[model samples]
Target: MANEVVVVMVPFLAQGHLNQLLHLSRLISTYNIPIHFISTATHNRQVRIRLHGWNPNNNLIQFHDLDDPIVTPHPIIPNTTSHPNFPTHLQPYFNSSLLLRTPVADVIRSVSQTARKVAVIHDSLMSYVVQDVCLIPNAETYIFRGLSVFYYFCSTNMNLGRELPFEPDKICQLPAPGESISPEFSEFIKLQYDHQKNHVGNVYDSSRIIEGKFVESLKRDQVNGKYHWAVGPFNPVEMDSDCLDRHICLQWLDKQPARSVLYVSFGTTTTFTSDQIAELALGLERSTQRFLWVLRDADKGDGSVGVKAAGPSHEKPLFDNYQTLHSTCRSVGLPEGVAGRGLVVREWAPQIDILGHLSTGGFVSHCGWNSCMEAMTAGVAVATWPIHTDQPYNAILLSNVLGVAVVMRDWEHRDELLTSVMVEKVVRKLMDTEVGEAVRKRAAELGGEWRKSMADGGVTHEDLNSLISYIHK
Candidate 1:
């Protein structure tokens, strides 16, 4: 063990970024490599808690707390939730990352003192890591692309103004009709590359596409001398947590017929207007299909859609909470009489377990990368309702290119919140009948292939070995 290598994993503060990177780290540990996971105290504690729950090989995984000197003292808006007419508040987080140069660099220096090869694996969004972490004398730096391979292709070429086949102005969907992006794709490219110049690291993406036609297209891209190393779609298997009643839902699911239930959840940051949530709630009820929806209470804070102020004229006590809203669901637009068919998971739901259940047939998701991978890994086809960021693009991949999901609405499709009537139709198509059955079979087949591909002699397994070899050098 004298020559054992140690790595540092630095994920952006967001929940999605942390989850993916943690899984990636766990996967790396299976090869018997040790890793030091670094983040703010709050986030590191959360990761520690989650890892302890998984009961993995703990000796290989260590957590370090980095103090955010700048933002620790400053609380900009009293409210952390997303609000109308307020400026986007992401700049503060970016500022905090830049300020971590001292503590993070010190950690690097301490690790370099040991008799081991050291490397830093960081989220692409962390501009400071590229600026500072690479400066550490002997440690190599690599970026973990938490986004899809599709985004990587678009970001690289689009930065070079390489005349992409798809129009940059429109939301870049896959095969057929699709949605649009914010700030547009081209602009997004320039801003990112500006921070990425002169960086020291290899690029690693979470995409599972490297084994498919995407590999060929990626080869073509590499001819231009820009390349990303594939060590992923680092899919998570068997999630367990103290957050919810892990057994109740699964026990209830066992009684349902095969492919009978649809699982619905938007990731942590996703939110909807009251009108939209009501429409969605009623849609589940009216669809008459067994479903589990994790409509968490908005009052918990963080960025989520909030209800508008009610006028004095309306006698109804404005619906401020999901639990209360559930009680009088009819007042807020749920269809009458369907409680027995659906369960509202307000605490937390073991997402991976639920997805893997035989009774779970379909997913109605916001098309986040982690959620998409989970559904694919579990062989559950999806009903896409993308909300923002890279989601519209993810939806296209699932519904169009992969043929594993069907898009109900792109992220920006907001003429008005979709009515319950619209919801029922989409749910039915995803859960019951000829089209759903076909997609379900396709998803299962792909899942089997992906699992095989991650095993011994598989594509990702080899790529991971290559990554480790690269770090050793």
Candidate 2:
């Protein structure tokens, strides 16, 4: 019966979204179902190269590559400046994604012919790609939300003209739909929103242990009797050998004391101004904590490119490659004395491995959902520094509701420059103070609960079983 069903995954073209759906595909494939993971050729290649925790060469999960869409070059904003327009710069990418509708529909149709039931699961933002799924008699469509149920609940309430039960901070209050995006992108967003209204249900990269109340609230408040499932912290429980070999950060982490090092990263979509980077560097130094910082520019959709390290300064830096460390320190304008205290990586780091390592105590993050899930699963507390989109809401959930993180800056103040003094204070608060310890303890407890939820007979496992059964019926 399982072999008579096929799952088709259509993930949005960003790292966070792509990674979650890929993890979902793996989970679904384990049930003996054939899975088709479709995306542009370039994106498929990117997934293959960056995939960890599992081999992409598995027989049950197959990659279906669509031709790349012709997109104009987006303007390259300098790394030294803040991106005020933010995601508007991603308009070209969004526009290009719409062009995949026909090809995606074609794939769904072809697969439906062989399978008794074709399950089309798409990222919420990519719903337009599979809008025609309803036209196929044997196919059903589901939306995959790559974020917390808490964020979605609040946002949906606001969109429906319902008032929030509790007062929210300015940053936590979500912007109205299409308010912050380009007109072209706004139209694209509308299409997805329209298509979402007719979907069967939602699949979240979240779990009840993290947001049980919110999940229940969404279920009760849903108007059409639609159902949803929380089967997430989508990263695998066991680390594969391939993940261990991907980065030098893991080797450096090996020498640090347990619960000592801070892992700092702003995700793939966020980039700090040069001044902001300098302030952060100085702050990490003043806090006197051992840190591993992944510093890179926002991905521009072309491909990953290495950032050039600058020349050496007077102080000696700590990596195996002294020259590279010295150059990284000089480039980021770190204080000479900070050389031995930190490691700055210019490319992608194995985040899952780093977080899962015993030495990692806290995270300085943009509070993207994927990062939040990774930190939670690894039992590391966070210093929340949200940039845009649903991040502010995730930050609020982490700091205000869950009590697993500390707020470094509010989204309302994201445009203002954060000074080194404030950075040092926040870093110290999250790393050296009693407050930090309390949050760390709570985070560890939550991590334990979430892990169990993924075990047999737990909430996540049952949810996965329910979803598979739904498809089979």
Top-TM-score structure, candidate number: 2
| lDDT score of residue 363 within candidate 1 | 94
Q: Write the per-residue lDDT of candidate 1 for residues 1-473, one digit (tens) a residue.
A: 34357888878866678777887788788777788888877666554443322654489888788764444322222111243211123434544555665777788777777736777887777655445655666676776777767655555565576655655444344322212332333243344555565444444544344234554466675544543467665656555534464445666677788878898888654445555666777788778888977664321122222222122232122233323233322212222365456776543456777888878889999888878878887878999986655676678678767889876775444344677998999998877778888988898888887777777788866777777777777
For candidate 1, the 10 contiguous residues with the lowest summed lDDT are: 78-87
- Where does candidate 2 stray beyond 4 Å? 1-3, 78-85, 167-184, 241-246, 305-323, 326-336
Model 1 regions lying over 4 Å from their true place: 1-3, 50-53, 68-91, 155-211, 222-227, 238-248, 297-336
RMSD of each: 5.7, 3.8
- Candidate 2 accuracy as lDDT: 0.79
Q: lDDT tens string, model 2, 244-348? A: 354667777788899999999988776565567767877887899999888776677764534432222212232223334435422332346666568878776
Quote the RMSD, in angstroms, for model 1: 5.7
- CA lDDT, every prediction? 0.63, 0.79
